[model samples]
Target chain A: MINLPWPSGLLAQAAPAEVDYIANSWLGIASYLIAAALFILSLKWLSHPRTARRGVRAGEIGMTIAVIGTLLIYRAVSYKWIFIGMVVGSLIGAPMAVWMPMTAVPQRTALSHAFGALAAALVGTAHYYTLYGDAAIDRFTMAILAVEVLLGSLTFTGSLVAFGKLQELVPSSIKGLPNQNAINFSILGAALVVGIWLTASPMQHWLFPILIILGLAFGLCLVIPIGGADMPTVISLLNSYAGLSASLMGFVLDNYLLIIAGALDGSSGLILSIVMCKAMNRSFTNVLFGRMEPSAGGTSDDIYAGKVKSATPEDVAMLLEGAQRVIFVPGYGLAVAQAQHTVRELATELERNGCTIEYAIHPVAGRMPGHMNVLLAEADVPYDQLKEMDEINPTFAQCDVAIVIGANDVVNPLARTDPNSPIAGMPILNVDQARNVVVIKRSLSPGFAGIPNPLFAADNCLMLFGDGKKALIELVAAMKEG
Target chain B: MHNLEPKLFTFLLATFLGLEVIRRVSPLLHTPLMSLTNAISAISVVAAIQVMSEGHTTFNHVLCTLGVIAAMTNIIGGFWITDRMLKMFRREKPRRD
Candidate 1:
């Protein structure tokens, strides 16, 4: 068990009266301050791509220093067990970092939140156990501990459910026990009661396990009803939960750095969640309780029986020769086909053909907020050419052509034309306003919202049926030959 | 209990400061921002280390060990994964030839 005397040996010899104690304590404080400074800088640098790599470096160094500082505090104690834990963690973390695909970043993030929250909860649980009934443990610390455990436990399971939905381990459709919302709320209520009771009566330790169980159940229930289409928001929300849990764990531990860092994480996550919801024209309550997309409507057979106007790559290239301005709108289909690089190459080729090319990015265009931007950025697309929805929506009409590349709902005119549409009221890229529109997709299928797009029927629209990357490559070749 | 005031003050300050920082981030960087923030929240590693180092009994040791493992996984995995993603999001394109 790696047993070592706590109050004896080095601890007794290095007691507060000794010079070593003062030196060690001062060193610890200095390390913490430096680490905190690095973390703040990292967050600031993370706001832009140019400095983001340096930001990651700063965070890594700060975390390393924090780990070292903690190890120094308990230097007198045997670290056999701690080292073992560190080894096990690295074993899992390294593969996940190296082997995970870029498309699965959202799910990876969810899993990270799950682990982080579970750590905070476990720490609070351990602290309460170690100091059980100790008169020195005050009510405020207990209350914070209760908060830490509650958030940690909920985020732990909530993030797991989110990960499952994103990975399609469990069906992404809404599945919940009867009276799911009511049951979830009652469980949360019960946990809060137990937490308060524990705060008031430290001796009544029997309530601790019950509180943990309820919180975990609440987390599972919270994310189970959310479908995969809303994974981005749910993942962000779970991140906020994990952050708040860490912040409260800081209070219980009297660690200011943890408090600040956790608060930063929590607040930013909440803001991102709100932004995602707003982009979808939905509220937090609706996102949490409402079904993602109603499945009541099927694609109308009459609309696409023979109405889809298919075009060849050569035809699109010929059309591009006359076009002076073109805007490319991308969505999840682009991501699915991994066509970002090919698309960028096509844009470059079009630019060379004496045409203006710009990207129109909807906030919720891909699976996550800014998913298309990341994919485009990876292909080294000029940042200036990448335009947000509001910035490009008005400019579409001035363009000669709008290239809708593997995108559906974002360019669907039904959002504005049909009030009863599932995606109604959601802001969309105005590709329909352009003089001519070209869509590169495999088929005239319904998008994530399960609604058929009427933009396909517009007289000015042309559908180029094929894989996104393959179609774009062919178009690029056609342009080169001409 | 008496230390509540300072803790609450720090909490409020952190909250406002965090929101202000988030407001400045462009929509283009939201996914990276989410991942980066996920990495930073691994600050619980500080508490996890302390817990493992301080626990006296076998039960305390085992429980704290689990916490340490989880916290380390979060810190290491979160930071490394974010770095890998950001590295791929450069502004320079690869050689065409």
Candidate 2:
């Protein structure tokens, strides 16, 4: 029996002898290219609700290819660990994707970002441990590794906190305690100083873990002061952090592919954050330190406690009868009620009754950018029939009936009349302009922005209080009966 | 060219393709996403500085400088643009109302 060297034995058993590097590499490259194409296609498809499912599928396929490519190149001593990790990840991730309510999407996204950050941090730490004593590892490599570990760990912890806030595990809106920002800045400053010192003095390896701890503290300080309303931006920012960490790890590993992918992810995340900020008409600085006064007012119970003029589904259906045109304004309420499909069904019925139906989307209607559009599209609402704020605001006056589904601040008349209102200047859908307005809500509650809506008090506006989906379904039934 | 380098190149190309898909499928526009992505591109700045400071060739130094500048544009300019756009949303009351 021929005795093989231990290194050879490891390599031989790790990969099949029949495997062709040329073919495998080509295949890997091809798979990666295909994945990239799919990702792009998915993004394009996602822009419209009609094609979003296809886009999601495309993205999934691309990710699969990426995973396959990584697996192909990876030479692991033990296969069990990798398989176990994959299984565990899928088990945890699949159910969460399916079971999580649409209302908790922002929290889900934040958690996903935390997972990404943790993965990057783990990779950096593992890489550092593996190559610690190698003479080939230079000061630059060590510095990059330190930076990656620090940023990744911070992103992981910070994202978890953001997730907690979004999930309401902690209070969603907390004002910074006196000197909170100061303390946060000081902690961050100290962490940066320690990080610089550790990198400068390679001899003091003990300082590395200390730097990581400081980074974790900095991340906590960074996210804790941010309000819940700004969670989308925070999630995007954390995503960027995770990407930067991945890029830094790429540098440490001298992997060009990782560098490119990381850079792309980081840039995209940053852009998304900016877009979200723009949608809310807030600067990044404002989001970070601006303590946006919680939309000043009483809670939902206080606002809805008054005599709300409730309309039954039959009444709403009768009101819709003989209406020349109907416009539907959807808000986060619609999303929370998961009433998109029902709204689409209602719209079809209304259209069949010789009433022109259109959807009015406010710029900042839901929690995140494009929230309303995404929900509407999910229900297979036609893109052309959906009108942006600028377009539908004019049309609202011509509509015979305006149906508001779970929308509040965006349709409130106070934005135009009340100077003291927090959301005064922000553009809103002019649902109040319609001849008759019917608001479908669970209660006469304030929206996420926490301001009283005068639209509810308007003489023409009739409040239809109930679950948006159930109300819409009943309305559809009533319309059929009429 | 080495076989490994070509494979690496292909991998990069594939990643770009994936990004394009994400850009398309996303409800947001690619231009904005790309611009925002520039912020993450700042990692290139650190990478460039570290690589150049390591006393590499003049070509490497030039490359690093370019990378740093591009990354800075993405970070600073991107943030500035976002700030300006958001400022427009500041609530101003209608005088007559």
Candidate 1: lDDT of A450? 78
The digit string of per-residue lDDT tens for model 2 on A312-357 reads 8898889998898999988877877888889989887887777888
Q: lDDT of all the models against the reference? A: 0.81, 0.62
Backbone clashes in model 1, listed as residue pairs: none
Leading candidate by lDDT: 1
How many steric overlaps are in each model, in order?
0, 21
What number of backbone clashes does candidate 1 have, counting pairs of residues 3 or more apart or in separate chains?
A: 0
Relative to the real complex, the DockQ score for model 1 comes to 0.58
Give Cα distance to truth, residue A393, candidate 1, Å. Answer: 2.0
Q: Residues A190-225, candidate 1, lDDT per residue (tens digit)?
A: 988999998898767888898899899999998898
RMSD of every prediction: 4.3, 12.0
Model 1 lDDT tens row, B75-97: 77888877877776655454465
